[model samples]
Target: MASAVRDRTAGTTILDALETYLAAPKPRDPGDPSREEFLDLVHATPALRDHFMRMQRNWETTLAHAIAEESGLPDDDLQARALARFALDIGALAQESPDPAHALRTLFARLRNGWTDFPHPGP
Candidate 1:
């Protein structure tokens, strides 16, 4: 998933590559457990829960570094951006959407355009 971000040789921005990657179709097993079920299982297993947390942290770190390369945000802000992005992705997955992957692409498109369609008041 982070391959797009790490491979800059593709001549695409991190966001662009990420969006493209997200747009790719993935096969899902209908028999697989739901998100809630998966969480329940994780909570029931101490080792799994710990491992899950560690993996999430490592992914966040990878994301932070990727985002920082383009945004030039300070470390704290970069970390926050990475966390927020990850949360948004999780939220998209959690929601009952007909096209979550498309939603993700739209989000990146808006971001790549500097979100010009929306007004932003500086803090």
Candidate 2:
């Protein structure tokens, strides 16, 4: 089941769709049939939601680890918390702003600035 979810990249696809929707100048109608069908499919399949949640968690953790490594921080709970917090803030920005790409660029710049205090790991 987990393998199936991983293969499908369902969570990423859903997230991409949501971002596209959010970025649209004129959003789709609330009663859109395709949107309704997608929601219905997710509602009818419990495993899909579970898989998405799991994939999202895994993606966050992986990103946290990468951030820790890049920042030369110990791979500890504190670093994970920092990364998670940053992600949550970015998520909020994405939801609130029509230009999510710009929000993401700002996020990456902030993250890079945050890493300036730490010594980079030598290649």
Which is the leading candidate under lDDT?
A: 1
True lDDT of residue 54, candidate 2:
79
**Candidate 2 per-residue C-alpha lDDT over 2-112 given as tens digits, one digit per residue, 9 for 90 to 100:** 222233344553223333433445566867766447657866889987886676677666656554554467766686556555664576576456666787666555665
Instruction: Report the lDDT tens digits of candidate 1 across residue range 1-123.
Output: 455566755567666666666666667799998867898899899999999888877766667666665557665575646644664464446344676766675566666565557877889
For each candidate, give its TM-score against the true structure: 0.57, 0.41
Clash pairs detected, candidate 1: none
- Which stretches in model 2 have alpha-carbon errors above 4 Å? 1-44, 88-97, 101-123
Give the range where candidate 1 is weakest over 10 consecutive residues by summed lDDT: 87-96
Candidate 1 wrong stretches, greater than 4 Å: 29-31, 39-54, 67-96, 119-123
Question: Could you tally the backbone clashes for each prediction?
Answer: 0, 0
